[model samples]
Target chain A: MAAFYSFMAVLALVFIAAIGAGSAGMYTLFGVAIPYVALLVFLAGFIYRIVYWAKSPVPFSIATTGGQQKSLPWIKNSPWDNPYTVTGTVIRMILEVVTFRSLFRNTKIDLRVDNVKVVYGSAKFLWLFALIFHMAFFTILIRHMRLFLDPVPACIQKIEFLDSILQVGIPTLYQTDLLILVGLTFLLLRRIVDVKVNYISLAQDYFPLFLLLGIAISGIYMRYFIKADVISIKELTMGLLSFKPALPEKALETTFFVHLFLVSCLLAYFPFSKLMHLAGVFLSPTRNLPNNTRRQHYTNPWNDPAIKPHSYAAYEDDFREKMIEAGLPVEKEA
Target chain B: MYHAKYIIPALLVFLAVVTFPFWAKGKAVYRVELKLPANQTECIEDTETMRTSHMQILDHWRDKVVREGERVYTNAKGVKYSMSLTNTCMSCHSDKEKFCDKCHNSVGVAPYCWNCHLTTPKGGK
Candidate 1:
């Protein structure tokens, strides 16, 4: 039901963009104003969320250690898994962010041998799909800089070259374009097919996937099938970047509007949604902090300086008369 | 903000990266203006179709000529032309720099057609 609703929501967005921008010819609304507004909201909301998380004090060295701790000179420790120093923690974070190390280590339990034996098996498919999706998405994002940047940079050109190295189609089929679709399909399928994952999934989980798939499909449709005017599209994007927005003289393909509108929706919905994981991954305590609780003392941020601890002797001194009246044992004679 | 020292710098870097185009091309606006051939009034196809799908047509022509051994291309108006990039297409769009390279360079599209076919100069052969 959640997936159904999310799919409908994405469909509704496509229709809205198709009608509002394509049919109505509200070029300014979809082409210029919405993009700016979405960008503003994305940046502001992103900063707000990051600051909110940053302000909340993590008072413990609660790194999720998967290996031996840094102790006893003779004992070996897995520095990458259970980091004890700042340098080791940094390396661990790089691995977590770049490779999704934790997700790569993900496992699934299964019942076997007439349900008498339990087996743990590596679930690497999710990791592989997720990596493919993220890497392709990142490359595509960078590839889009060509549209935004006037006199496109050589590095971006090189990326574009590498992406279209296959040269299979007329416009040069980008490998990432296909990979992104495959990744999204596998990810959405995992959520739907896996009963455990499906049971735990919410509208949020399905919504972004659908939204992204919508964006990717629309973009691919525009590029491959519709063959949107790349020159005019670049002009519009460049205009937006320069804060001097203008609709192209020729009407753009409806798919272009749908793609842009979906992108705008993603940007606007990003900070508030699970998509904030892009930033949250960097600040995750388990991945970012060092596993050096034994080596270093941690001061709880919630501790109050005014709340002094009462010694056992002081406590007894205060309750001596009460203890004697109650005929309870006293440390000193009264 | 417990680790303002690290978090603040990281946020700044993110902002810089996202907004690179704004500063990188500060106050500069460029529009690609292709120099159309003076003598030719019409291309093989209409302007809109050519703008969007010229590459597709060229690819189709290439496949038809090389794979199927068919070299003649008949357009919508029943005008037959040789399926030759150099002798037909470049015969009119001779100035590769002004006509093709303007938008291509601006959009950073490096078409490999020139890698094999010799580019025609400004004047027709």
Candidate 2:
């Protein structure tokens, strides 16, 4: 049901773009204004979300340690997994961010053949597909700079060369294009096919996946099938980048508008959705904080300096006469 | 925020990276101007089709000539021409640097046909 709704939502966006750009010929709205608005929202919302997370106080050293912590000199410790120092913690965070170390360690529970025992199995496919999706998406984003940058950078040119090195078709199909589709398909399938995952999947989870698939498919269709005028598209993009905001002399295909509109939707939806994980990962207390609670004091952020600690001896001294009258044992004579 | 020292710098870096193109191309307006073939009012196909699918048409010609051993192509108007980029396409649009490379370079598309084919037409036509 969640997947169906998300699919319909993406289809509705495609229709909106098609009608707006194709039928009504609102090129300025779809091509220029919406993208600019989406970009602004993305930037502002992203920073706001990050700052909101930053404002929340983490009152404890809550790093989720996976191995032996720093202790006796003779005992070996897993510094990467159970970091006790700032340097070790930094390395751990780097590994976590770059390689998705936590996802790499994901496991699945399975029943034994006899149905008498539970077994833990390595579930690496999710990690692999997620990594592929992210890497391909990032490379595609970088490649798109070709449209926006004037006198395109050498590095961007080199990346485009490497991407289409296979040179399969007339315009030379990109490898990342194929990889992104494959990754998204697998991820979507896993959510639908896996009963356990499907049970937990919400509309928001499926919405982004469908929205991204819509963007990727529309982009691929425009590039390979429709062969939208690249020069004109670049003209429009460059115009927007420079704030000149002029449509090209040549009319762009509706597919281009669909692609642009979906991308705009993605940007606008990013910060408010689960996609904020892009920034939230950096702020995760479990992954970012050092596991040094045993060696150093961690003062709670919510602690009030005005509050004084009362001693048990003082409490007993105050209650001695009352305790004697009630026939309760006193710590000292009244 | 307790870690404003780290978070603020990271946010700034993110902003810079995301808006790289805006700052990188400061005050420079870029547009590709191809030198259309002189004295030629019509191409084999309409201007729109050629602008979009010229590479595809060229690739098709390449495969037909090299793989199928067919050289002649008949257009919609019944005009017969050799299926050769050097002998045919570059004949009128002769200045490869000015006509072809202008748009290609602007768009960052480095078509590898020039690696094997001569940039100038054969025998300097």
Candidate 3:
């Protein structure tokens, strides 16, 4: 149901782009105005959110460690996973940022059908899908440099060549296009099929996936089927970059507008939504800060920086009445 | 599960970004000056089509003539011409700097054509 609403929302945008707006108006709006607006919003919102996060100082290191910490000299330590030094932290950050190291260590528990016992096993599918999705998406974004560039750079051409090396079709299908689609499909499927995930899933969780799927589908259509006007697209794209957007003289196909509009929506939505994790992941203390709390004293830097987390004393206060009734030790005989 | 106070300001920013088309109009005017081909009365395709689909036509020519060795292009108007960029399109529009770079730079695009085409050199060589 969450996915359905998200899908409908994206569909509405597509309708607006593909049908409501005239080719000329839509071209100017999608090609120029929305992109500009989206980029501005993305930057502003991202900065604001980062500032908000940064202002909240962590009184404790609170860095989650998955392996052995730097301790006694004789004992071996997993420095990359549980860092005590800057170099260890950098390596950890690189691995986490590039490969999702923490998530890679996630184990899934299942009930054995033969007996009533529970079993734990490796579940690498999620990690694999995430890795494929991000890597392919990044590659695709870089490959688009060819369109924006005049005298297309050698690197972009090389990337383009590498992307379509399989050359399965006449126009040479991009491998990233297929990989992104497959990745998104698996992610959405997990939200629907996985019981725990489905239970906690909200409309917000599904919207980005649906929006991305819409953008990817429309993009593939424009590339392979309709083959929209490339020069017109470049003209619009370059015009946007140069801040001199003129309406395209040649009408590009409607599907291209659909793709552009969905992409614009994504850019606009990014900063305000869960997608902002792209920035947040870098700032998250749990992932970024070195686990050196054992060696350093980290008192609250600012008195009001972070709202004081609930303490054991506070928890006991709220449950004191119940504790007395259950004959457990009570605070002030409450 | 988060603070409700920031919603209005956040929404204002979102509205501004999403409705940028309506607001961004006529703020800064940018003009592009096209250097009309020096000696040509006609282009290979129609003027309007050339403005939009010139790259597509050029790409088609690239694949057909350069790759497939087909040296003829019968355009939509049924005019057949030898499919050679240097002999046909650039012959009259030989002033690549004045003619091509004008629009390309205005829009900030880098068409890789010149990398292989050599921009034809200066002094009509």
- Looking at model 3, the pairs that clash are A149-B110, A150-B109, A150-B110, A150-B111, A151-B110, A151-B111, A151-B112
* Cα deviation of B71, candidate 2, in Å: 1.6
True contacts kept of each: 0.67, 0.76, 0.01
How does the DockQ of candidate 3 come out?
0.10
Question: Which pairs of residues collide in candidate 2?
Answer: none
Error (Å) of candidate 3 at residue A262 is 1.2
Interface RMSD for every prediction, one decimal?
1.6, 1.5, 9.2
lDDT of each: 0.90, 0.90, 0.75
Error at A315, model 3, angstroms? 26
> Chain A TM-score for each candidate, in the given order?
0.93, 0.93, 0.87
Top candidate on lDDT is: 2
**Which one wins by lDDT: 2 or 3?**
2
DockQ-derived CAPRI band for the predicted complex in model 3: incorrect
Candidate 3's error at A122, in angstroms?
Answer: 0.3
Candidate 1: give the clashing pairs. Answer: none
Worst 10 residues of 2 chain A by lDDT: A307-316
